[model samples]
Each structure stands twice: as structure tokens, then as C-alpha cells.
Target: MSTLYVEQPWTSMSLLFRPHYRVEVFDEHDTPLMVVRESSGPGLQRPLRHTGFSGWTSFDLDVVAPHGQPIMHIAKQFGRRPHVRVSTPAGQLIGTIKTHGAWKQSLHDPSGQQLCFFTDIGRIDTGARAKRHGKRVRRDRVQINPQVTEPLRSLATACAVAFDVVRGTGTRHTSSGGVDWPV
Candidate 1:
């Protein structure tokens, strides 16, 4: 399958259940698909900003799919979660970005990185588009269901670790002091 790298219009602050974030989706050929943007800010911004905080810790991602599928495809067949390791000077441990719980929801970090779960063929934009003609206005676009998995927590965690190692790197960060702080 061909690889597709869609841009997430939303910011990290919006995905943390803290405030509004926006996202836009495109197909494998750079075709516009969907968009999701928030109309308001998360209430914690002012307070956090005042305290010299930017909300969440730092998490970097390097998606390793060839062209059309996520890297976790094979490992996912065995269990619920899949570990994804990123290659960097400072290696990172990325947990499985899978669907969890009974409802099989999409799981991802604030940056819109595909974690344990993966998306199927469909429009994945969460934004609404509007067209105006004279005094009339029309809304276009639809909500695309993201592919997610519902797996055991333990299995998911293990998959995350394995994913990292599979990529020829073995480093995991468990302490949550934030990346900007001094070591």
C-alpha cells in the first residue's frame, strides 16, 4: 500500500482533553479528505502559561510505514497493543496506538500520531467546510470513522516495547519530568 502522511491541523493542547484542537486529513495522493478544528481554547491555557508550563510533556514521533499501512500491522495480529520505537539520537519508547475499551476507539497522543491503533480506508478529517452562494450557505464533508482496537492493557504495553525494539532501537522513557527540564 502507498504511504500517506496527513497533516493534523489541531495542536497538542487540544487533544489532551483540555481544550479544542483542529485536524485535517488527506488521502495517499494528497487529496483533501476531512478536517477537525476546535472553536474554543482549553480553559487551562492561561493558568498554565502563567506558571511557565506548556501543558503536556514532550513526545516525538517518527511514523515508519512504507506507503499505505502502519508499521504495527504484523504485531497487531498477535495481540491488542503494538509497541512503536522511534529512531533518534535520544531513542524513544512509543506505546501502542491502538483501539481500546469495549467501543474500539481511536488512540493517539495530542500530536495526532497514530499510536497503537491504525486507520482504515476512509475520510479521516474532523473539520467542516462551508460554501456560500448568494445569501445561501451549504455545508460539506462527513465524519470518517478511525480504525482502532480494543486490547488488554498489559498486551498493549508489551506491544509498544516490542515495536521500539523491532526498529533496531531499545530505549524507553518512563519518568515524566518533561523533556525541557535539565537532566
Candidate 2:
């Protein structure tokens, strides 16, 4: 790891109720080191995500290199707290992201040691990326403390996208308080 760090940015846009994401992972430099892609048909998960409980539905997301080499894997787990298990390409568990509530998720290493935390501060409309969607994009790349391990920083950031992959795929957010706040 370098002395300087930049938050790796990830953007997700759903198509026809199917979630798709594009992530640019950065470390040790200002530019991206790799790409994380979630590209797959809904298949059986479609109907399952519709009527089934989230704990009963399963899906997998991957972070891969530009050459299509696997880097990290995310498999959301069945837990009352909405935990997501992150692993290496070889299936070795690396870290788990367990949500404490709607506003925070914590990263735990394989040994059940909590490493760091990422928080959701709601949607942000700061740039063309957000405007491209005609809506605010959820801020996924919360700054990980530089003291944390490199692997943990990357894994936690990549896995953060799972936070927004709505299980029911309907309008989860609606206008409230006459201010259009997300619910």
C-alpha cells in the first residue's frame, strides 16, 4: 500500500429489475487498478427475488481484472443482520460485510475480527454520473482508513455494492416528507 489512498468508485444501474454494476478499483495510485463487473441474467433468481424472502434468495457478484481474471467474490448470506461473505477467486473467505443497520456495514476478517466499517450517507448527486441516471447515486466508496490492510480495503469497498441490490426490485424508495427522501 502507498502513503496516499483514493476511494475506489463503483456505480450500479439496474435494467428491467436486474441489477448491474461497474466498479473501478484504485489503490496505491489515483487511477484504477481493476474492474468489477456484475453481468448475468436473472435466471431463477428473478422469480425467486420477486415473491421469496431475501434470506431464501441467493446471488453471486464478482470483481474481476480487466482481462477477466477473478479477484474477489461476493455471496450474500442468510442472516437476520444481512451479512455478505466476500472471498478470493479460489473460494477462500477473506472478509464478511455485516450490516449493523440501514446506515452502516462493518467488515470482519476470516477470523471474525472486525477490521473496518463503511457507512451509507444516503444518495449523492454531485456529478455527471449521478445526472446520467436522472437520480442520485448511492455513495458506495466510503473512505477506508489507511491503517487497514490493503486486501480488506479493496474487499470491503467492492462488496459495498451489495447494499443496494434490492431484493424485491420494486420502488423501494419513494417521495416522503414532501422532499423526495429515500425510504
Candidate 3:
């Protein structure tokens, strides 16, 4: 997976309001896929996002089809582990993304069993991708347990999108000085 959007410089709209995220998803060859758009009714619209460390920064993102049909729901709950839960639009359990620290993240079953591991750059556990393609590319890709299939793939896709959102984490620079939610 690849992230198709980042911050654009000096847009008038961004100058006036809190920046809204519209994260596009793409394939390895750069083909457009689905989109992970930030919530329309973003909770309270704050300056910080819940990065799993601290603060009340929470977010709801919808992975949608090109025609805008809901695919899956990705949400970040309050925690110190940088977890983003993935579920069906109807709220069926899919999985959770749990970060152990700055260097590693793991995909877990709803029952809390580890499925696979991914580093900040790419897969790291046993069957890790042999080599990384690019920085943003690695950030956009998360190794899914091959055992996972079907609509559940949407959950993995959402996981990749979550990594994209938090790619640079506290390091991204925006005109408005916001970290994760860049304009």
C-alpha cells in the first residue's frame, strides 16, 4: 500500500480552519485504490491526535470506495500503545493494530493474539518483506498475516492506512504547526 496524499502548501482553506485529512490509498505501482478520509464529525476538533501515548486526541476514519460506500471503519482509542481498531462498517470485529514502541507494531486478533509483526518501515517478523522499496512506501505497507482473507483484507488495508496517517508521527511539519494532521 502507498499513501497518496500528504500536506499541500499554503491553501487558503487550511489557513482558516483545522485541517481535515483525506488520505488516499494506492498500490505498489502507484495505482489509486480506496481512500481513508478523516471523520466528518471529528470529535471536538482538537490540535492533538491520540498517538497511543497520551492526550485526548482521537479520530474516526472511514475506508471508503471510490463511489463513497463505506468499506471499513478505523478508529483510534485512548491508550499508550498506539492502537487503531479496525471493524466492519456494521461494527463487526476485525482486528487491532498495537504498537509496542517506536520500532515495532503488531496485528492482533479481536481475541488479542498476535497475527504478524511490522516495523515502522516494513514487516520484521519471520517472513518480513525481503527488502523495502522506499521510506513512505514502507510506512504505507504493513505485513498482514497470510491467513487473513476476504472482507477482512479491508481491515488490513485500513491498518496500512493507519500507518500512513502516523507515518512521520510527531515529525511531520505543517504550515499550521500541527504534527499528525498536516495541511
* Candidate topping TM-score: 3
How accurate locally, in lDDT, is each candidate? 0.29, 0.48, 0.50
Q: Per-residue lDDT of 1-183 in model 2, one digit per residue for the tens?
A: 132221223223222232233445444444555665554644555554433243345546787765788878877643345567788889898877766655556677888788766532122111122221354333333344456555676555554434443222221212111322221
Query: Pairs clashing in candidate 2?
Result: none
How do these models rank on lDDT, best leading? 3, 2, 1
Ranking by TM-score: 3, 2, 1
Scanning candidate 3 in windows of ten residues, the lowest lDDT window is: 124-133
Candidate 2: where are CA atoms >4 Å away?
1-16, 19-32, 48-56, 78-80, 119-128, 131-141, 165-183
Residue-wise C-alpha lDDT for candidate 1, range 60-127, written one tens digit per residue: 32223234232222122212233322222233333344434322334344244654333332222212
Model 3 bad stretches (over 4 Å): 1-19, 28-30, 49-56, 119-152, 164-183
Q: For residues 1-183, write the lDDT of model 3, one tens digit per residue.
A: 322322122233333343454555554565656777766644553444322222224557788876788888887754344677888889887887776654556767788787765542234221111212421212234354455564445544665565533332321224224533212
- Indicate the TM-score of model 2: 0.59
lDDT score, candidate 3, position 63:
81
TM-score of each: 0.25, 0.59, 0.60
Question: Model 2, residue 108: what's the lDDT?
Answer: 79
Worst 10 residues of 1 by lDDT: 167-176
Score candidate 3 by lDDT: 0.50
Q: What is the Cα-based lDDT of residue 5 in candidate 2?
A: 23
